[model samples]
Target chain A: MQSELHNGINVDIQEYADLIEESPSFQDEQYAALVTSAQNLVSAARSARVTSYGSEEGNGHMGLCFYFPTQTDLDSTIGDAYADLGLSQASPIWANYVNSSTRTTNND
Target chain B: MNLVLATTILLFLTITILFGCSEDRVTRTGIEPEADNQTWGVLIYAAGNYEGDQLSGPSMSSSRAVATVRVMETELNSPQTMTQACLATPAAQGEVGIYDVEFSPRQPVGLLNSELVANLGSVSTGDPQTLRMFLETSLSQMHADHYVLCLAGDGHGWQGMMGDYNNELGMLIDKLREEIESVSYLLPGGKFDILALYARNMGTIENVYELRNTADLVLTSTFNVEQPHHKIIAEWYRDLQSQPELNRDELAAYMIDAERLAQDTSEAVFFTTLWNTNTMNDVAAAFDTHSAQTGLRPAQLRLRLC
Candidate 1:
């Protein structure tokens, strides 16, 4: 994940990839625990500044980003690099999503 | 008439002055004692040639590297703290220097009076060997109970961090972990107490997980980290000096507070994360399981524009 200007790249892909994984059986308790843990993490992150910008001055900064490529990104050089990563090979979650997006764009 | 009284008073004053000037009496000569074990040793590796032409004057003229050193000099003051910085700047021949930095009480704040300990003639800052060499030399020479290693430069996320413009090289993420691991044994707990990444967009799972074993705590940002904001690190040092018993978690929290507070609305997009290397394994496992259950769905994959 990269910023708008491409100066910075987000590296928190593991958590995002896990979030994409779905089970046959719904585990409410487990999901609740995950949510609680995520909330605790967010709470621990105390900011001194009243406001932090993401895209613009007023826009808030999102802490994490996952690899979910669109049709345009899939057709670009970045898509090739993304495909080459070990995570892409090990986990088909992101790859499947990218393929679906590409098919949707092609169909449109 | 009172010659005996005057002589006795002069003699007493002379004796007091002599005792005050005793070698045991501590004075702020600003020079650190030789071979003394320090409470903390801060090792800073800054790739200073981030901007400007290589053939021109040095790139550290007003770079973040020099600013970090200045912050350390002014804010980091502890008799038990030893600070060293290895700066890689683009000179006529691409100069790299190791400096022993200390706060000079004699001079006003904001002005650094650092000592150049050694000059490494033309070395690639992007090389893992160079980083390992610096770590080895600094850790072996500067004996400390705890160490904080600060890596400052531009980051390439998981690919690597730090760009050596002169040599046109970048240190790979895996290589970085290997370099630090090589010197981890010399550390008190077989790892650095804190690994502070003073680069932009290095708060990735790939890099952090790879380096989890090398440090107890990892301080980095998922987005662009304002280099000037790193002055909070010097403040953290000051706090650490005042409270030597502050644990790693507490210190990490303190840093988070300091960094967040240091930011203002004037700054654009500030986000930093303090990863506890101890629990990284749990995070990885839990997330892995969750990913397996959910799998990949187009409907679930929401595109975040930001």
Candidate 2:
């Protein structure tokens, strides 16, 4: 997503917050309340913009990853909730340590 | 006299085989030696109506469901834990019937009667109502001092666990919570002992937090659940029998130990989290305070262990 300028300056965390607050989709209850809650947290932290990862345009400012002051801060803030949604599953299912050919079936 | 007796016995046996007993009748009337001491109730919901690349094993939910039920049968019949566990698992798109497993018979699921399922008409395996009916029926008719509800099959964390070929929404965690509560209300005594998520990559922090108030203990892995998921469970029951009453942490530790020894799936090698649901409020409180400080929209902070 293009970072729209505020007063002709780079958008800061506060501006990001305003954008998130305005979007009705963020609070959509159709999804799990937990998903909504997690997204809301990420939206609030986007303002920090201390670190940005992911693509900016097509995916709409999607890949930015922020750096936190401390690991504990991250865990207490959004990391814990993020992990719950299976976001870490974004990692490759097979880490090469385990051969896929022999992957055990949860089924028979 | 001998010929007459032999012919009469043969005719009697044939009649009994043809119409003597029904599976449902056996389930309602049959008695296990341990019924009075039966503390654990195992209920499995397997939603395998379709297949995709992101799945494991036979890819047939029904077969795997029985495979798991069979593995538990072996454990329950073992000399060490003959009377410790009782089970009822529903696999595939089937009617809502809880098969209370009995080991002496070596049946796939002891209320096993394919005829019963066919006659009743099957429900989509992913329907929460399926679970509700199973629990409601089992608790009312089966004897158990406690219970363990196992939801096996593909799990997309809080997105939902069991998927139905018929229903797009499938069985969400909220629906599961409602069913479990309903069972507890119908059969009140002990807290619902545990809710086991035997699906893949389910050990998420948020999912567990959402279930903190749902059960006393939650057993699930954060990564993809490797094959032979039922082996660890059987052994856990065996061990728990000897160690009868463990607090949440102790039970979690035991499960971790069982997984290490029996399950070889590398995906299941490390990502297991035991939620003593009762203690989750404190954990959630920590997150809530930080989220409060971070405001409504927080950043995905990258932090490393020192």
Candidate 3:
């Protein structure tokens, strides 16, 4: 999911945003603590997918996706992260995409 | 009488120095000298010097150059029309000699200095100037009407030709533009025809931006070049060598066909090609990949998982 064309990590920014909300006090400058926790979960998901071939219930939801409460939620969460990081506001910002494969997709 | 002799001596010295300078003269324009006949030039700059401990680990670039030159010699009928420049290792610790490769059955594949040879030096491949010199020598001396500059070495996609070697692809393209500009002057229109990158990770979109103006056509790969990659390309060239007249696009297409066929045979980590040219502008081409994972949304990326 990492690319030179785009900026930042490939995982969903909203997941990190949700985790950051959980922490009462503000963490490090760039929300390092929140990102670290989110990244570890992503790593676990990726590791699990390595052996997750036969475990599929065949529901056809193995492909990952990101859903928002609203499109505004998507824009607010992803756009704010982009502004904070000073990354290119171009097409290939994959962090905004729901390009995950390691975990099952749901309306979480 | 003494003044006349001294003047004559000075004139002689000046002539000799100028002539010597001309012999070593490098054209920085990066332009191709125009020729009436169709001539093909392939320059393979193989930087095998691996900095530290990796030097001892299975280095085959020198042999790979030998193999490619051998193929060219064997398959190609018109030796005079085709020219190849190979820069490779086994000379010194951090340097490589750029050899003028001709199809000589009597001689070895890469003989250092022969009647057919041009220049000799253990030039550092890590230096950007050295890379420019190699290209300059090819365009100025070979005098090919049409050129196919092949980068046959280690490469990192966006970072460029050689990250460890110090030149980035972007800067290399910047340097090459001057040469391309020089070549463009001779022709009715555009610059030197094709740039074939036989190294690793050179077919990405990141590379396309750097290479847009440097070459008319680029033959590059998304994956790290495998052991069998060069041999497959050689085989393709051997087959195409029979065809007397094939334009730039046809030639590149043939190479891509061979690449796709070769990708089928090997279990590579990743394999994709970007057949980029002036004609195929801004279009993203997808690859036919094989994978074991049974993700229902196969297109989204099952190949990455497996």
DockQ of every predicted complex: 0.12, 0.03, 0.03
Runs with alpha carbons beyond 4 Å of true place in candidate 2: A1-108, B1-34, B48-62, B78-96, B104-120, B187-190, B225-227, B240-252, B265-269, B299-306
- Candidate 2, fnat value? 0.02
For candidate 2, lDDT tens digit of each residue in B152-196?
A: 666765556666456533565556666677666654354566677
Error of 3 at A103 (Å): 32
Write one digit per residue (lDDT tens) for candidate 3, span A1-108. 221111222443442344345656535554544334334433432322211111122212122111121234233433333222211112232233423323232333
Q: TM-scores for chain B, in order? A: 0.78, 0.69, 0.64
Docking class of 1: incorrect
Point to the candidate with the largest lDDT: 1
- Write candidate 3's Cα lDDT for B1-306 as tens digits: 999999999999999999866443221111222233445555566554443112223433344544455555445444325455554544344345665443333444333321234444655454566666666666566655566767666665444353333333322333434544555554324555777676665654335434556677666545544434456556666655566356666666666566555444334443334334542222211111110111112223221111
Shift of residue B118 alpha carbon in model 2, Å: 10
Per-model i-RMS: 8.3, 15.9, 16.6
Worst 10 residues of 3 chain B by lDDT: B287-296
Q: What share of the true interface contacts does each candidate keep?
A: 0.09, 0.02, 0.00
Name the fnat for model 1.
0.09
> Where's the lowest-lDDT run of ten residues in candidate 1 chain B?
B52-61
Kindly provide the TM-score of model 2 when superposed on the true structure, using C-alpha atoms. Answer: 0.56
Pick by TM-score: which candidate is best? 1
lDDT of 2 at B159: 52
Model 2 chain B: lowest-lDDT 10 consecutive positions: B78-87
